[model samples]
Target: MEMDVVAASELQRGGWDVVVIGSGFGSLFFLHSYLKRHPDHRILVLEWGASHSRQWQVDHQTNSAVDYQTTISNHGEKDWNFSIGLGGGTNCWQGMTARMHPHDFELKSRYGVGLDWPISYDDIAEYYDLAETVMNVAGAPDAGKVFPRSAPFPQQQHHLSRTERLIKADRPDTFFAAPQAKLTSNVGTRGACCNNGTCSLCPTGARFYAIEDMADIWEAPNLTICTGARVREIDFSGPIAKAVLFESEGREYRAEADLIVLGANGIHSPFILQQSGILGGDPGSYLGEKMLTFVEIMLDGMDHFDGGTATTGFELSYIDGEFRSRHGAVQYWTNNSFLWGGLRLDPPGRHRQVFPIGITVEDLLYKENAVVDTGNKYPVIEHSGFSDYAMKGLDFAISKIPEVFSSLPIESVELRRVLPTADHIHGSLRMGDDPTTSVVDSSQLHHHLRNLLVVGTSVFPTTSWAVPSLTCAAMSLKVGATI
Candidate 1:
């Protein structure tokens, strides 16, 4: 491998410039930008999961060699889904890549709901374009006009279904093509979307896998990658971080670095920080998201799965409104999978009946809903439930959903059961201008330890209805370039 990977035992103490925990989107994107600025800097990446190749995943029909449930001990009713392998969440993420609305940054200031992010949309807009280009994001040509993109998506969006075309004809601006990393057109070694209905382990490498596109960053000679290494804690003294203590292959090892970057997702990152007793603030708190699913019965026999990708439509008709003040705003994603997400078997003869939609609601952080450290790789989920704001948002969205499609075909909408988990974890280490209310700063730097940075969605100040991977990647690029 060109990326100079090594075993954890090969790690030397106090000899690295930067030590990045986890080899997911956040870590790789940061390294991609950071290495461009400081080419000769020695880097070390420690991943908790096995290094399974793309072909291995396809053949095995699973993302990781490590079973996610076995990795985390969940005592609560909520289930948090994430991959614990070389590519991290990138191996298992649905390809949706929507940006946070411009107003999302100033939720507290503008909408009087949720906390405002320390950074503004203008501050990271360019980085969003950069992240999209790197991932070869296929999206609507007119996508993100309200969010206000400086540049268009790298690839044109896939063809919408016939029914969706009619829906767009009514209000083209409300519903835009889903911004996704799945290639609509081929790019170098990456192939176009085969639309085979299986995306997590795409058969033709259509979906954006960090391993395929970011191999250069992984194989860089200065960078050393160590898989099957789970970071347990950060070793810091007063105001400076010294090293990371991790477990690998039944043995505990210490890897020291001048700077430490914790990108181990919302749950694990906070667990490590809390265990270390870092001076910034509480690392593991407010860990929950609102998730619900619904099925729309197309009375006129309209086809639903004709879109090019799994999730082809984003229901923007209900999101980003004045309703966010009292209750949270919801993100509705049209599930375009006839085989998996959008099928009604019970109502036999009528095959093309459901226009399946998945809903994600924004929730204010609750201290009670948290992860407690059990000194194991698995975190104890103390999540009670979604906030009343989130529940209210769901109620409002469910009520308005029928009206959204009211202009289209006549059908009976069946509100499905509320999902136990959205699988997208948020708010373990919040970022803000004030250290009193946050764990990291707008720059993603630790207030107490300047040499330490908490990257990824874990540092999110407020959870938005948007999928966090895109914004997380943008934040990685922004802070990665500067540091």
Candidate 2:
């Protein structure tokens, strides 16, 4: 049955089997995985934005969403509501897909800074393989062995651009293979990437957005996708989530289900939890804290040497305990190269016409400063500390850019401002073995509500260097199978 878009107040209690909030890759993966495993279970997903088509571009960009309110962080309307329409962030993502390493799961025990995950790398290795297969990553293997390995990526990394090749030869150690969601060959229902490099607003779905991948599941008999809807909170009676309150088209609706999956992104998921008044009153609370994102900055004067995949490979030289990179996670993509992705900073004067190579650092959000309810629709994120780490990583990466491009003037290298956005933001309503500390369990079940579960980066305890979409999808699959 097709998902019916309704207002938050009008929804009949107990109307759904599983009610999923959010349309990003997290929700898409969970919905796909659920319907794949249990055909009889009815799954309803709610997205705040429109369908993933060119008409939905909020900023006239191809695949980007254009119709939402602008915020302080990302410049345009593309930075709309945290959770919108069918694809979620996957709709606007640059498609740099990779799995979180084993070490990432144990950052707290090994590094003694953050908390260790309830699960480990061994638990999700195969799922990474499965995720890559699903995403259809194109690239050659990391010959230098930078990222942890389990199986060969479904497709080798995409070919580097001519400028990228030159930079690699000029500084072989500085550059790595670019992993992307675009296919080199037909995988599942998608085709090869057209290499327009206009992937951000891919006019065509060839780039493998999760929504496009889930098109089949949308057609499936068991799953229903409800778009143009916004989930306000999970309605709980005592400890059990009996329904969800949401609004759409200036109206209200409620949905009740045996199982409720919260796939809202890292920010909004916690906003919903706190707003529901289910999990509150814990300042030192492990739940709704410790969110992570790769803090990225664009070097101002670095030559725009090239373009292609948004992310090449990353370096782990900073991963070891002795590395003075920072207490939180930090990995540098080869953004110093021209057009190869070091400049993602949108300067105040250059928003309409310039693109910079952006250097992204997997900055860990310290438990000290993370998302907390400020009694608003969104969580108040303390970003001062993480901002500092991002600057440090940008400095480190910029210092080496000239080594790869001697033609580019070193002194002319202008370090521009940083962008406060993240494609991999995870960790809000984290899952754990205990409800006292976590909002959900290992099975993705809500701690207080037996029926309510969340599957997304929000459930992650520690943010890893790899993109969270694949891991989030993997966990969602595990959860969906149970339903």
Candidate 3:
């Protein structure tokens, strides 16, 4: 299937009903929901990267032609990672679909910590189910027991790993099969996961790639996709975003729109607003994410790599409770990536001994951490570091290492140094009711500029202890319903 890509020069006389910047899950899901409610509306999507097809990505063993470092100026110790192509982060995500717990929405109210989201989990619960079905999310049957859901998952649960099974046997209420966007069964051209361990570029196309799965919006008669079009800033005076100023093939162009959606990732979306001089409540302030950590444990007797996919089960044991009153919450994604995987088992019976658990600690966004534009194409990413709250969560999580895997005779649990980036960025242009505090409204529309909406994790006031993909999609889907 050929993408209906429009050339930049052919459409110099630009005018569109809706002009969305960035072609990520936030953008596609918003468009997917919007077009469903109001069909045949003119929509134009501006993506910074070219359309690198799925086959090309698998064949070349990469996602994009552009290097990630080349696009941004890094002034901090850590690196911010995200795919820049048409499908955006979906190209590189591990496909762990999760919903923010009810407490995540009311941090300040429930725990006297961070800001509370104007909306609650109950508001977007329907859309979470909608997105799950659209992606054919194969989740545990009892996931609804953990997080409140109105509907069951579209597909059945993935088989839990041996270590996970043992952990669940010991702590059944705390540990459960993780909800992922891979397939237990095939649907259309997409195949079931073959447990290749490399899900970033799924050779079987089992994971939900935006280009393949989100074709409802991409191939709609109402939408036009323009690749290699980098939006510089919005042309707006006070409340209205009149036009989008962008560059394509060394030439700058202005595309007028009735409504403009800034679906750019967490960092760039605020940078775009800052460059455009819309700085109420500091759209460039408080830019950071929950710190990413990996905790690995060597099992004794359990032969582990039996999951249907890479990361099969999840542990919500440390996610909530009174600890959140002081320290941030923590969540776990049990991964199958060992330092020495199935390839080289030096010992005769050391086939599946290494059990790696991916961990994320909830964080408080600091005013010092921010994204600033220094008159460059990309914004400079600078950070002070993680707050004491987040560090304490990590410390607490590490303290529970022996207990987390106590079912098995735990040999050792090591805290490998924190990874550079989890690709879960947040808290730039956050949502709230007050214009002096929040940049966007509860509906994700700008407080002052009502016509301009900022979608994706950029509007996330607080980062939860899970991947931001599913939450961001739910927020975008809600935006679509309101608009």
Candidate 4:
């Protein structure tokens, strides 16, 4: 079946059974699962930007053309780094996929800090398996029971680069092969990983991009994807969502649906809710509050950049422990690519010897650090400074790196606090048991509007010290089962 790409102007009014607001991992996986159960139902997906194929990305030398606005806050100016095309950020992701540690869900109980997630790891563990299989995850067999997987990975782990091997050989307990969404063997139409370090722009379609992974569903007769459709407002009457009003090519259009699912990114999801005037009373008070992201610290070391997947190894030993009571949980990983382009080191071989290691610190959610509409076309980010706990975790993680890599004969180690570029934004429109403190319930439905479901990391109550794509995918699949 060929996927129909229709213009917003062409869509007939008031016929859709379900309307998905974004084409990212969350929306794509929701469509994939929902269509499997409700195959003949009328489904429509509205994407804000144009679709780009792998070939198109290669030819254009860019993954997305959507203009994402910068987030301004006390933390200073920063790019949200979200792609707004058919596949959304999956098109530009580095492919690292790991489940949030079980402890991440029960933060309040264990650490006496942060809010507990309404759902636990046990509730969504199977969904994680389903998502990993769909993404063709390649992970270490020896990853142990740290994340508590019921089944092994779908494919064998990718071979570690020489640098990764050295680090693992020295600290086997601390270092393990990082689980990634890229394939290790041929899987249906998708090809195997070709060891091309540039996963952000994978030419072989080996890495899992939502557009490629859900190609079959996108091509299904039941689904219709509308590109360049900028959803301006979600019109509602009482508790029911009536229609979605959007703009395309300078013309306004409306498409009605029985149910609406908002899978837009964290920033945009809340922004849309606010714009639509369906965010309950005091929208800004809780809807866009408590924005969270990982704080990264870079460590430069010697003889380490042996190119492979960008992130081939990670240290999970520090993910949780007594340290959590005082500071945030920490996780570190080695970067396989020497991406410092155009900068010529004074000495020739120094560039090859410099490897970047990143330490991720869990950010505490604060009401002051938030996303506000402020009458701007895009949301204004009023980010707060890092908590004392996060800073302590960063300092602790930096000090431990030298000991963990002591056997590598590292020559020079430089520690610098890099800007928040992990792109794992969370906590806007968070889900909680209380309606006053949260925007959505455990089922990810809007507390006020029962028909509206908001999937993705935006519903996360806390930020864990891991990549959030896999967890977001799992959450989408779980929501699909309910609907």
Q: How do all models score by TM-score? A: 0.96, 0.78, 0.97, 0.91
- Give one digit per residue, the lDDT tens place, for model 3 in 313-428: 88898888888889889988887665222332646777577787888999998767888888877889888778899989999988987877778777778677787777888888
**Model 4 weakest lDDT span, ten residues long:** 287-296
Q: Against the true structure, whose lDDT is highest?
A: 3
- Each candidate: RMSD: 1.8, 6.0, 1.7, 3.2
Q: Which ten residues in a row have the lowest lDDT in candidate 1?
A: 338-347
Clash statistics: count for each candidate: 2, 42, 0, 0
lDDT of 1 by residue, 1-483 (tens): 465666788776566899999888788789879989988998989998877777889999999888777756677667788888888888988777899888888899888867889898899999999999988889997766557887989899988877677777876888778889999888887789888778888877778898867877877878888887888889988899998999888899998899999998788888888788883667787777656555554655655678888788886866687889988888777767753344566568667767777788888887777778876656777876777898898888888876777655666777766777766778888888888768888899998899998888888878888888999999999998997
- The best-first sequence of candidates by TM-score reads 3, 1, 4, 2
Per-residue lDDT of 1-483 in model 2, one digit per residue for the tens? 233444444444457878888777666776666777678877777776667553356255545453433311321211213435567777777677655666777766776655678887667666666677777767557633655567787776656644456556664653566566777666655656655556666654557676556556767766566666777888888867888888777888788887787777676677677778876422213322211223223334543424445454444444434332353344455432334334334555432122234444555544544556666554555444343544554566556555534533333444554544554565566666756667777777776677777777777776555566677877766666565
* Number of the candidate with higher lDDT, 1 or 4: 1
In model 3, what is the error at residue 188, expressed in angstroms? Answer: 0.7
Clashing pairs in 3: none
For model 3, the superposed segments whose C-alpha errors exceed 4 Å read 12-14, 339-348
Q: Lowest lDDT 10-mer window, candidate 2?
A: 71-80
